[model samples]
Target: MAVRAEQRVDYLALDGEKSWVDFEVKVLWLVGVRGRFGSVHGMIKVDHFRSAATVEAQIDANVVSMRSKSHEEWVKSPEFFDAEHYPQILFVSDPIPLKRLQNGGEIEGTLTLRGISKPVRLNLIKPDCPGESADNCPVEAEGSIRRSDFGMSSRRGTLSDKVELSFSIATKPMNGSSAIP
Candidate 1:
């Protein structure tokens, strides 16, 4: 009898060219401040036999774009992201059920920002075409995190500690095969 091999699927974010990681935080307890990281790269690996998937992503903190140059400068300063010290923000998810990713659910992951790692849950959105194709179709998720948890606890009364995060990306096959193989 022949043994059957386990199948796996992998997707790449295309060097993060078509990916966007945006954030919005409340300022002065009333105004909303927004910004986005310009460089992001990540990969998704799905194990068919195990019905599990994992995601790993990285963001360049040095390439942040905000509403104003002054705001951008403030974010990159030691009081915030501190790009000089920690230039990269990383997130790696625990193995999640493939069905959860397809059907839209929470994905548990650890986000490492400013050299501090914390558990975060992102709400995944179901794609338009499920189990059909991952190319062109964007995979999106959103969640919120407290800045103080990552050691950015400088401004408690001025800037809201909660940061709303939005992530979206279009992926291509990592090995020249379809999403499911």
Candidate 2:
């Protein structure tokens, strides 16, 4: 029987070109505040994670947190994310399907945020390691979308409708490694 290895969310993008994909996933968001940026981080529980890979991870209000430059503005505004009421965002994928890319391969996935789920897919164009390194095979994939769909209308007039979200994550074999990224 052929061993069909499952893939995970490796990395994501910010701005347009600048991105990070070295064992970490980050969500960079822009708000109405100047010099203020917000981020969310989480690790994929690969074992608890289902393969064939249709999975849905709820970013718990307790587990996932966000930060802003000013505590007053951050705390007072429902216009911004109400971490108290709606504390979790959801990312649900339907058994990620891979399509062979011209360079390597690509994956199509779905992500849900603010109680809204949409089809999201990324191009996993690079293999984990060159010449087949299953042990330390590195995988890089990415995809994006507009935030308005989820009703994030704070900066609707100012923020770009084309909120591009992308990621680059490298997965290692289940060798009792730590999930601290």
Candidate 3:
């Protein structure tokens, strides 16, 4: 069955275990640094029959984690995310039209980072709605963005401008029941 507007799935209950948001960027034009936001919350409403979906998400910038302490601090600094000023990275899709494949599809949306919003297209892989519950679904998406476009122009030559983003989100009905882990 298709999910209606009233059946929107909540993402807050899926943090850490069932949901994750991560990114990667190259440093010194060679070294790859990977990082992940420790907290993320969102909602997704899909109209399966119409192949349409709406996604709204917020990522906690303050909780970003990296392999090294220095790297983590740098990412949260004014030159980058500036978590103190912009505590959240928000994303709201523009009534995405899903082109369903055998197991996955493509979804386009707008991502706002450091107060800058830009259009982004995510390649979904193995997105699925398990069982008969439209509220219980798993989604995976990957995309990329340019740091310079978002005003994150620090260490221009030392840090690569391209940032790759990937996320897995699982949702459950928000009818006072616990989400699946």
Error of 1 at 40 (Å): 0.7
Candidate 2 achieves a global lDDT of 0.42
Q: Cα lDDT of model 1 overall?
A: 0.85
Provide the lowest-lDDT 10-residue window in model 2: 15-24
What is the lDDT of every predicted structure here? 0.85, 0.42, 0.75
Write candidate 2's Cα lDDT for 82-163 as tens digits.
Answer: 5566666555554443323214554655666555677766655555455765334434455556656666666555555555
Span of ten consecutive residues with least summed lDDT in model 3: 7-16
Error of 2 at 52 (Å): 4.8
Best by lDDT: 1
Tell me the number of clashing residue pairs for each predicted model.
0, 15, 0
TM-score of each: 0.88, 0.49, 0.79
Q: How would the candidate models be sorted by lDDT, starting from the highest?
A: 1, 3, 2
Ranked by TM-score, the better of candidates 1 and 3 is 1
Which runs in model 3 stand beyond 4 Å of their true positions? 1-17, 97-102, 128-137, 176-181
After superposing all C-alphas onto the true structure, candidate 3 shows an RMSD in angstroms of 5.3
Error in Å for residue 93 of model 3: 1.6
Q: For candidate 1, list the clashing residue pairs, or say none.
A: none
Question: Residue 160 error for model 3, in Å?
Answer: 0.8
